[model samples]
Target chain A: EAGVTQSPTHLIKTRGQQATLRCSPISGHTSVYWYQQALGLGLQFLLWYDEGEERNRGNFPPRFSGRQFPNYSSELNVNALELEDSALYLCASNDLGDYGYTFGSGTRLTVV
Target chain B: AQSVTQPDIHITVSEGASLELRCNYSYGATPYLFWYVQSPGQGLQLLLKYFSGDTLVQGIKGFEAEFKRSQSSFNLRKPSVHWSDAAEYFCAVGARSRGYQKVTFGIGTKLQVIP
Candidate 1:
């Protein structure tokens, strides 16, 4: 089975600009999660969407927001990007009630 | 709030040598545990997980982790290290309550293999 898929392997944006990253969950998966991995840092949770609802979010600012679509695909939007916003944004999916997650390769966002 | 700790920032091991990476967690209740590996420029990959029952859990790529409730620890181990095993590893904890589960990940440990 195909694992989670993300678009735009790499993205470059300037400070104060906005960026959008997309993810497509694995087939039959209902939960999509977003994570950010800054350079030399671990994955930091961003948001969680299940059944078309925003279930939870991390400590990130409101500028980091996203939503899940009816088809279970997801989009992460980062507004007012700063140099610190540069990171690899990952997307993961899992079946409802399942603990394991399959992650996407991630979009490498570079904010200048 | 739940948190995971991976004390080792980096570790070096020779090929064919046994390897162990430590992890500890702080949670109010029993937490689902997991280990994930990420090669450079790649996404994280699940190595193994422990929900309950057996303390020892085997995972892909010949990796395994042992959960110790007394220590509140889950350490990943490989009987024989391979050069390909060099990657960043993360330990995570998931709280299963309130009709949902929220996961928290560690800072990660980077493994270096010397051939």
Candidate 2:
């Protein structure tokens, strides 16, 4: 089966602009998660979506938001991007009954 | 809240030498522990996970981790270091939250294998 896939491997946006990243989870997966892997901050949980509902979110500001589509695909939106907002955004999905996740290659967003 | 801690920011060992990476976690109950390896510009790959029943869990790519509930630790170990093993390894913990399970990852420990 195909693993989780992310589009626009690289994205460049100016400060104060908005950016969107997309992810397609593996087949049969229902839970999608977003994480920001900054230079040294590691994987900071951004959002969690299950069954097309936002289940939980991290401590990030409201500018960081995302949604899960009916097909289980997910999109992460970063509004009013700041220089610190530049990082690799990763998407993962699990069966909801499992203990592990399959991650996408991630979208490298660069805010200049 | 669930969290993971990888005390070591980086580690270096000679090829064929043994290796160990420390990880500590905090959670309210028995947590689901996991180890993932991430190559440069690549996504993370699950090395192994400990759900229950066994303290020692074997993972792909010749990796293994032991879960110590008393110490609240799950450390990854490899019998022999391989050059290809040079990468960032993240320790994670998963716990029930908001009617669903949420995972938290550590800052990650970068491994350097030398000849």
Candidate 3:
């Protein structure tokens, strides 16, 4: 079966602009997670969605928000993007209550 | 909350040599431990995990990890290294929150294999 899928492997946006990244979880998965991997900074959790509900989020600001679709697909939105937001954004999926997640290749967002 | 620490930022080992990556975790209770490997421009792949039962767990690609409860550590080990094994390794700790798994990752350790 195909793993978690992400669209537009690379994206470029101007500072203060908005960016939207999409993800399709593996079939039968119910939970979607978003993470930001910045240079020098490790993976930082952005958001978690389960059953189309926002379950939890990390220490990120309100500008970083996302929603999960009915079909378990997810969209991550970064508003008012800044140069520091240039990093690899990854999406992962897993079954509810599962211990591990399957991650996508990620979208590299460059804010100039 | 839970956290993970991979003390080593990078390591180099020759092919055919044994390899070990250190990992430490802090949690109130027993946690779900994991080892993930990511190649350049690729997503993370599960190398192994330890939830319960035997402390020693075997995973794909000749990888294995031992969970030490006393030390609160789960270290990844490979008997023989391969050139393809060169990548960044992340150690994570998972805890149950609101019936879902919440995971935290370490800074990651970059592995370099030499011939």
Candidate 4:
């Protein structure tokens, strides 16, 4: 079985621009999670999608949002990106209510 | 509110030396604890987790962690370190409350191995 997969391995966007990152969950997985690993900020949870529904989100601003498709794939969109938005955005998948999550390689977003 | 803290920002250990990374968490109920390793420019990998039952849990790559509820700590340990062990290690805590699984990760500790 394939693990979680993410598209656009790297991205470079200017400030005030918008960015969209994508993720596909593993086979038979129904939950997708998004996390941001910023420099010196560690890994922060961005959003959680389960069964095609937004379940939970972190303390991030409203400009940071995402959604999950019926196939359990997810897309994270950042509007009005700032230089601090430069970070590795990771996607993880797991069975609903499962304790463990398998993560993807992540998309490195660089906001210039 | 749940939070995890890894007091050590970075640690350097000689090859073949013992290693221990400390992790502390604050939660009211029994928290699900985990340890993850991330290589340079790579995603995080699960090392091990502590849900219940055994206080000591063994993980892949000859790593292990002991959960001390009284001390509110779950520290990762290895008998001998290898150069390959040099990476960023993260400690995470998850709550199984309200039928939701929300995990909180620590600030992470970067390990440097000296050969």
Candidate 5:
């Protein structure tokens, strides 16, 4: 089975621009999550979506937003990106019935 | 809120030597614990998980972790280290929120193996 898949493995954006990263969950998975892995920041939860509904979100600015499609694929959008937004944004899926998440390789966003 | 802490930021072990990575968590109720490994430039892979039942659980690549309720800790261990084992290790605690499970990951412990 193909694990979670992320697009554009790496992305570069200018400061104050908008960036969108995409993720496709494994087959039959209904829940999708977004996380940010930055230098010194570690892995921080960003958002959670299940059944195409935003279930929960982390302690981030309103500029950080995302949504899940009916197919369970997810997109993370950062509006007016700052240099601090430069980080590896990882996407994970919840399907094992437990909380054990299968993560994608992640999209490395570099804000210049 | 649930939080996980990996005290060791980085560790270096010689090949064939034993290894142990410490992790501690704070949660109001019983915690669902997990250990994941991520190679540089790669995504995270599940090593093992413990929701309940056994205190000790075995995972991929000959890795194991023991959960201690009293200590509120879950530490990963390996009898013998391998060079390929060098990677960033993360510990996480899972909790339910809004009918979906939310996981909080540790700062991560980077392992360096000396051949």
Candidate 6:
């Protein structure tokens, strides 16, 4: 079985631009989570989506938004990207009410 | 609110030596505890978790953790360290997801293994 999958392993955008990151949860998984890992920093929760609904989000700004598709795939959008937005964005998935999550390799976003 | 703390920022151990990483959590209820490892430039992988039942749980790659309720800690341990074990370790506390609850993570502990 394939684990959570993320696309465009790496991306570069201007500070004022926008970036979209995608994720495909593992088959049978219903919850998708997004986390940001900055250089030399730990993982910070970004958003959580389940059953195509925005379940919860972290302390990020409104500029950081995302949605989950019916099929359990997810898209993370970061608008007005700032230099601090340069970090590795990770996606994880798990079956609703289940245990631990399976994570994707993550997309490294660099804003210049 | 639930939170996790991994006091140690980094640790170094020689191969073939025993290893232990500390984790402490604060929650109103029985918190779901987890240990995850991430290699350099890689994603996080579940090392082990403790929900209920036996306090001791075994994980892949010769990893083990003991959940101490009184101490409010779930520390990760390995009998023998390997070079490949060098990586970043995280301790997280999970709340009642109710479908999706926030899971808080510790700052993380970076492990270094020497030959």
TM-scores across all candidates? Answer: 0.97, 0.97, 0.98, 0.97, 0.97, 0.97
TM-score, cand. 3 vs. native: 0.98
Q: How many backbone overlaps does candidate 4 show? A: 0
Mind giving the per-residue lDDT tens digits that candidate 1 earns over A1-112?
A: 9899999999999999999999999999999999999977788889999999999898899999988999999999999999999999999999878996889999999998
Compare the candidates by DockQ and give the number of the best one.
2
Q: Is candidate 3 or 5 superior in TM-score?
A: 3
lDDT for residue B28 in candidate 6, whole number 0-100: 90
Residue-level lDDT of model 1, residues B3-103, one tens digit each, is 99999999999999999999999998888999999999999999999998989999999999999999999999999999999999999999876777788
Angstrom error of the Cα, residue A72, model 4: value is 0.5
Candidate 4 structure quality by residue, lDDT tens digits, A1-112: 7889998999999999999999999999999999999999999999999998999898899999999998889999999999999999999998975897888999999999
The list of candidate 5 runs beyond 4 A from truth reads none
List clashing residue pairs in candidate 3: none
TM-score of 4: 0.97
Off by more than 4 A, model 1: none
Off by over 4 Å in 2: none
Q: lDDT score, residue B72, model 1?
A: 94
| Docking category of candidate 3 | high
Tens-digit lDDT track for model 4 on B1-115? 8999999999999999999999999999999999999998889999999999999999999999999999999999999999999999999999875787888999999999999
lDDT of each: 0.93, 0.94, 0.96, 0.95, 0.94, 0.92
Q: For residues A66-92, what per-residue lDDT tens digits would candidate 6 score against the true structure?
A: 999889899999999999999999999
By lDDT, who's the top model here?
A: 3
Worst 10 residues of 1 chain B by lDDT: B95-104
| Each candidate's fnat | 0.65, 0.91, 0.82, 0.59, 0.88, 0.68
Off by over 4 Å in 4: none
Question: Which stretches of candidate 6 lie above 4 Å from their native place?
Answer: B97-99
Give TM-scores of chain A for all candidates.
Answer: 0.97, 0.99, 0.98, 0.97, 0.97, 0.98
DockQ of each model vs. true complex:
0.75, 0.89, 0.88, 0.79, 0.77, 0.75
